[model samples]
Target: MTTPTLSRRLVAEGLGTLLLVATVVGSGIMADRLSADTAVSLLGNTLPTGAILVVLITILGPVSGAHFNPAVTLVFWIRRDLASREAFAYVAAQIAGGLAGTVLAHAMFELPLVQASQTVRSGAGQWLAEVVATFGLLAAILGGLKHARQAVPWLVGLYITAAYWFTASTSFANPAVAIARAASDTFAGIRPLDVPAFVLCQAGGAVLALAVMSWLLGDALRDPEVA
Candidate 1:
């Protein structure tokens, strides 16, 4: 099989992020419209997001490691699995794709194309939730890839699904996603003012995961499986 070029990998990252965010934002919109109960709406939002994540990661993993998240790409860069320049490119693509996805979701639902979120996701509890959520997400990816590469997709999907329920902030766990979500005013939205805290917590979580995984898994951090 021919190895994919850098351009191809970049495209995969962008496209995967686009679809992932679309699933998240679009499902949230639909769920909010369909259910009066907040819990029911959340359940409606969670399932499709998880399922689509599994599909996207499974299909795009080989192409670009299926990062679709700036935090994940930053982790790989820290581990030296990806070069700095490439990592930056991946992050940029993810952010752009995420914005596009949020816009697309609004357009599809006939909502305004752009609107700042009024949904305030703040407080110490929510920040802690983001930290824990992101830590678990990275841990699942690294551990699954180390022990069972084939299971990484499902592991990630399930983790996010559960995290949605357990975490106060519903596990945004991703900087790019958080930024994009600030533009949305629906169920999945987070106020633009709240994004910095969430992103900071996410970054901290990624660092924690990298350190813990490096210690616990030892050489697995450097294993080709991660690549």
Candidate 2:
């Protein structure tokens, strides 16, 4: 099969991000509306997000590497798997797509088009959780791609599902996702003021993962067989 053009890749990235964020935000809204219990609501939100991720990654990976997360794109750029200019373009697409996703969710739910989140997700513990969550996410992606490319989608989906319950921040490892979520006021939303810290911790976590993985895997880190 012929490789897709850069424009096609960009479209895939943007579309994937849009769908991912829609899954996250829309599921959150649905969960809240359906359940009075917080745990049940969380469970409802987690499953669809994870499952959709598996589907999206599997379908879009060949086209754009399925990097819905800006953090992942940045990591790939640092590892020289992606060019700097392309990385920037990918990030812009992700952020724009993410915001569009929130808008779409709002439209579906009959909520305001854009509302800053009031949900406070702050504190040192939350920051640490973001770091750990992002670190683990990148590690899973890299390790799975290296050793079992066929399982990368399932590995990522399961990891994020678990991270949602384990982490204080519910594992918003993607900067674009975090930023878009701050525009929402639903169950998955984070305070707008808290977005910068989450983004920083995510970036830090991604960098640390790349460094350690590079050390552990050596040249294998340069080009893992991703699926």
Candidate 3:
């Protein structure tokens, strides 16, 4: 197969972020309205979020490397999996897609678009949680891709689901996703002021994951086992 161009990668990032944020905001609204219990609402958010993640990954992986998350881009950039120029293009597309996704989600749900969430992320614990969540997400993405190609979507879905359930931060590992999710005041939304901290932790996680992956998959990095 021929190598994909930077423009192609930007398109993929744009499309992937669009679908991801739309699914997240859409599912969060549906879950909130449909479920009476808090548990069910959370589960409802997770189920669709996981499903859509797989779908998006399946569709966009080949074109833009399916790097819907800024953290993933950073990790790949450090590892030489992606070029600096492509990384910049992907990030720009992801941010644009995030804004567009928020707008679309609000319009679709008839919800008022706001810059804050009902829930605010604060405290050292939450910061640590963000780190853990991003680390796990990057780890899964990097390591799982080693042995399996066709199974990527399912693997990503499972990883996301587990992150949602296990991490206190609910695994908003993607800086683009977190920023987009912050565009609304819904259950899935986060605060704009809180975004910087979370994004920082996410970057840190990516760096940590890169180091670990480098140590563990030195051969794979030199000669990739999976695309």
C-alpha local distance difference test of each model: 0.91, 0.91, 0.81
Winner of 2 and 3 under lDDT: 2
Ten residues in a row with the worst lDDT in model 1?
218-227
Q: Write the per-residue lDDT of candidate 2 for residues 1-227, one digit (tens) a residue.
A: 67777798889989999999999999999999999999999999999999999999999998888999989998998888887898899899999999999999999999999999999999999999999999999999888878888898999999999999999888999999999999999999999999999999999999999888878877676662243
Report the poorest 10 consecutive residues by lDDT, candidate 2. Answer: 218-227
Candidate 2 versus the native: TM-score?
0.97
lDDT of 1 by residue, 1-227 (tens): 55678799889988998898999999999999999999999999999989999999999988788999999998988888888888999999999999999999999999999999999999999999999999999999988877888999999999999999999999999999999999999999999999999999999999999899878998756542232
Clashes of 3: 0
Prediction 2 global C-alpha lDDT: 0.91
Model 3, 31-80: lDDT tens digits are: 98998887898899999889998888887777766878889888777777
- Candidate 2's C-alpha runs over 4 A off are 224-227
In model 3, the worst 10-residue window by lDDT is 218-227
